[model samples]
Target: MANFNDSNVLSSTFYLTGIPGYEAAHCWISIPFCLLYLIGIVGNSTILHIIRTDSSLHEPMYYFLAMLSLTDMGMSLSTLPTVLRIFWFDANEMTFDACVTQMFFIHSLSLMESAVLLAMAFDRYVAICNPLRYATILTSRRIIHIGLVLLCRSTVLLPPLLIHLLWYPFCDSHKLSHSFCLQQDMIRLACADTTFNRMYGLALVIFLWGVDSLGIIMSYIFILRAMLSIASREERLKALNTCASHICAVLILYVPMIGLSMIHRFAKHSPPLVHILMANIYLLVPPVLNPIIYSVKTKQIRRRILQLLAPQRCFSTFK
Candidate 1:
């Protein structure tokens, strides 16, 4: 076991791992992964295109949806090159800088996604709880400001996380558990004490994800309270329906995220396949599912998609 005193750690080559015992099935595994990438990329790209072209989706809600789509696409593309390299071509070697760069983008985009979801929850809150002031509360300028703030928040805090890891000397076993780099996986290879890194990472997760999750929950609580105050049951139902897509989007992201975190923290002795599958699901499921969810639930988006697919039928059905 190499320790902190290892002088060659900075130049060490890190290799990504595929499924532990299924080396021969790597090609088969790539098939599902490839399909997922295809669906995620095309699905998110289509959402972005529709949102851009359709005038009806120019509201604050769809604007936030567009941000979600872009973040999903970024997450997908961030993992694509290395994932495919490992599973398809058996090429998994990465230089120190390359691994750090991938780690930065993956984690940053994830934080951005959390922030976007939080913003979307607020949008729903305003639209449902204060319908009259929705426009004023979430103006275009304010939305842009929120976007800028999210961008900065997601990107700014990541450098210290990655920079700290750079100073730690790695052990002889520079093998990463997943197809892509993660700070958790990277720190495990460090020869020095990683207590600080682990604690700092936990602090980040608590601060970023924990706070965003609480904000989302609080928004929904207010939304529910305002919803119940409606005199008519039908009105309450109608209001609840508007949030279904966002609720689904939230679950799609945070569920797998929590699962992966648990596996990393608690399930140390579990099968390697568990970690790989959970990690992939955490990254891929939301990007693929969010677009489908919104397209199905948002009548405007659905109508636009139907129009693109079958114009006459779309008019007849919607009319």
Candidate 2:
């Protein structure tokens, strides 16, 4: 760690030898990941544009969808370049402030995305269960308000949480097991007793993510009940179908969080390369796959994506 008295500084200059073995294998994996990231960026950007330009899609559903895309971009911005550096250039060292910034953004966006998913679930429930009030409840003003609340909530919560992390003292072992300085990885480096850190983290997880997930499940329960009550079997089936993509998305994020936490606890001493691989996968999997799942599940979005990618007809009846 850096020797500064006041600022808790890890050293600025650091060494990062390339991946231990199978360097070529890492490169092969990274090449495909880079392509996936490119697709994610382009695809999400197109969705944002279509959502903005098409007045029909300006409701709360696509609004939350756009926010989800934005949060994914933020998550990618925080994780991907550092991961690429680790994979391609062997440039893994990060300054103390850089590492803290990375951690804060990654966590902040993650929390915000969770809140956005919550909003989406509420939207779905209302649409399926109470179509009449959906327009009034999910109006433009209400969505804007919800967006602000989500942004402010994550911003306020994450900074104080980060300050606590930053000031917690670290031991001399500056080497983080993961490709990026995740919360637990950085805490492992702490010189002070980190029981407090673990407890606080668990509390946050239970309160924020855990409770929100429960709420999503409840929303789905109510939605299913309402779907069953509908007179038309086709309407009931359609309502059920609309929820499939969100269920997949929720699984992608929360299931990985479980794997990541487990790996941090039981497998920290595992191979350094495996640690790095899981870290990158945890960050990349949800964002890269989310827009794809939603697009495939939602026909309107799929059509828009296809039309945007289609080559324009050159000489079709110019008159």
Over 158-268, each residue of candidate 2 has an lDDT whose tens digit, in order, gives 665667765675546677665666676677767777886788777887788887798899999999889888999888888888888888878888888778778877986
Q: What's the lDDT for all of these models?
A: 0.91, 0.78
Q: Where does candidate 1 have its weakest 10-residue lDDT segment?
A: 1-10
lDDT for each residue of candidate 1 in 197-303, tens digit (9 for 90 to 100): 89888999999999999999999999999998999999999999999999999999999999998888899999889999999899989988999899899888888
TM-score of each: 0.95, 0.89
Q: Model 1: number of clashes?
A: 0
User: How much lDDT does candidate 1 score?
Assistant: 0.91
lDDT of 1 at 184: 91
* Candidate 2 local lDDT, residue 111: 87
